[model samples]
Target: MSFKNDALAYHSEGRPGKIEVTLSKPCHTQQDLSYAYTPGVAEPCREIAKDPAAAAAYTAKSNLVAVITDGTAVLGLGNIGPLASKPVMEGKGVLFKRFADVDVFDLELATTDADAFIRTVEALEPTFGGINLEDIAAPDCFYIENELKKRLNIPVFHDDQHGTAVISGAALLNACEIQGKSVSDIQVVFSGAGSAAVSCARHYIRLGVTPENILMCDSKGLIYKGRADISGTYKEEFAQSTQARSLADALQGADLFAGLSTGGIVSGDMVRTMNERPIIFAMANPDPEITYEEACAAAPDCIMATGRSDYPNQVNNVLGFPFIFRGALDVGASAINEEMKVAATMALADLAKTGDVPEMVLNAYGCSSMKFGRDYIIPKPLDPRVLVEESYYVARAAVDSGVATRTIDDWDAYRRSLEDLAEGIQ
Candidate 1:
């Protein structure tokens, strides 16, 4: 499992990145060409022009999700520029196709200006069924989602924020249950105040965890009353009572340690300092704030999680994005509401608890039985129920909330629609 430059050499040597945006249908023969281009395509275009809603059926608008990024927060690299972020976005598009059956095209806006980002995304609204704003930095990310949701008629989801929230929330629900703690009775502390941190903290809050008990921390320390350093809408929206100057200061007797910051940010001491059977989610991608082994070594009673694939409980957005998007688009929904995310999280948690585990869930990190315990409280990213359960919950929530345009008379058929989407992804 050791990574080398050779893994990337072919990718660099080939045509730019991983994907090739070729035609989906054929036009090799003249008769086929007659229907596929020029005169034949004009009728649908004309119909679409006459009736804008008809574009959904006549063109690819209904199946497409736009992956827009400002190159401000490109994976772990961070602000690597539009050119550099292309690989990651292309990879994301590939994931959307391979995992969720959503056709995604990457859009890297040249400017980092918030208004420009807003205007740009708003302008492209007509082309896609949904807009997935990825890897844009916070405060700006907050603005972009808010504006796009307001302006666009389709779903505008900031995946780094909401997808991370839904998946992490699902894991934490199971983690809290394993630790014999409920959402109403826990003191949660998130390490690193990024998109993931805010989303996790907010999900906990929406799930009935008290805002006062949930302490969120950034680089300099906990984001609290006296912290004048961090001044943004995200921080201000979910300010905590714990005014500690360090991670250790915030972790004393804390029930949960959610890390969404850089690698090695949360030390072993931080995990050990928390309450008995503490739940830890060091969810920084590529590497986490702390490794799974390091956390377990420090506190045997702790339930640990990291944003990694080669380990147990890989809390990747892969578990959430596809199904979440599928549910939203299937219903022709306008926005990804928090209630839908909460329902998806709850569904995921419940799904992980049922039946025996799959080998795909086991992954490279061994241990034959993947039970709901310290090491394996959450389901793996590849767990099939992610789409099956979460999207069901989402579709139902969409209908109940009066946001969904598509209606399903039978619950089983709704479930089938979600599964069908997953089938296409594979």
Candidate 2:
């Protein structure tokens, strides 16, 4: 069957959707029903009323995330709107549950008005422990996340903005190691200045990349100083005072080319102009700025990755989000701070270098031999070790960074708990 038919059938089969709400507690007897609803529920509600923080202890709020979207930019299908984006949202929830065992409520907002969307999500703060903002278009997404982070005590994460940043950042760290290059000295060129692009650029900076050495290009051209169309705070932040006016000009001798733009935009010739042993992450989904074959044919020595499973090095965000939130929510983190993000990235990069690919992961990828090198810069999505490594480091960072409300006193037991969670997922 075709993919479209398969997808439709898969979603329509059995329960008619990808997810369902099932009670965690038993309700077999009449007494159980009464305790589950009226008397027992009321006691927890009364306790939560007396102390707001008790809600985390008595309810599902501690482990719940809201996968929210206005659907202005649903994956590669841009501006599909909210009602049409339910499947995507539900699928996101599935990832959250399947990967980290975290419960999710997929929330698709009906309106695109940023103010209305922000207010609506803000009101939902009491219901969820964290917010996973998905598929909202840029600039507005930046604004909404910033405002929500300030107003809401719970962690607010824009997966489009930070998920790509964390995953790609990990890959870049490993690639730089293989190439014997320093992020501080490398000249980086970005193909798109959207939410992911700008966020990744900033993330790179946090990971020791020099700001002035980076060049970001939007649809118009290279984002340079004095550009009339520079719209938002993030655009202005990356705007460079340089002689280069286009991607081609900026890419000459560049150490990295991060493509968060459209497919097939970077030709083989463009790849050939980069520095020796260049790192090219052509990460546009479904397709890329340059195909793996095309990039390899051009710059034979270049380390490459794309947002594709078929590719050798796939920059999948699945490696980051579920675990990041898992760590945050476990520790009752107020926000996913920069330290926590960097910790997760470093954990992923470190995990790859350990050369301890689980047999299950190897089998899932249909590979007999895989290790930290040019093609295997990041862990596979099914690598259950990620649940332990990424989440552990992120939670520890939250504690050290003063964002966590709860702390893990016994490191060994905490690791065991994470391992159990991973085993359950597997």
The number of residue pairs in model 2 that clash at the backbone is 0
Superposed model 2: Cα runs more than 4 Å off: 231-233
Model 2 steric clash pairs: none
Give the per-residue lDDT digits (tens) of candidate 1, residues 192-307.
88877887778878877888887877777777875676664568665655547678888889898888888887778777788988888888777888888898999887787778
> Local error of candidate 2 at 85, Å?
0.8
What is each predicted model's overall lDDT from 0 to 1? 0.81, 0.93
Candidate 2 per-residue C-alpha lDDT over 1-93 given as tens digits, one digit per residue, 9 for 90 to 100: 999999899999888889999898899998998889987789998999999989889999999999999989999999999988999999999
TM-score result, candidate 1? 0.93
Off by over 4 Å in 1: 13-16, 231-233, 241-243, 359-367, 420-426
* Model 2 CA lDDT for position 339: 96
Candidate 2 versus truth, CA RMSD in Å, comes to: 1.1
* Reference-based TM-score, model 2: 0.98
Clashes of each: 0, 0
Worst 10 residues of 2 by lDDT: 227-236
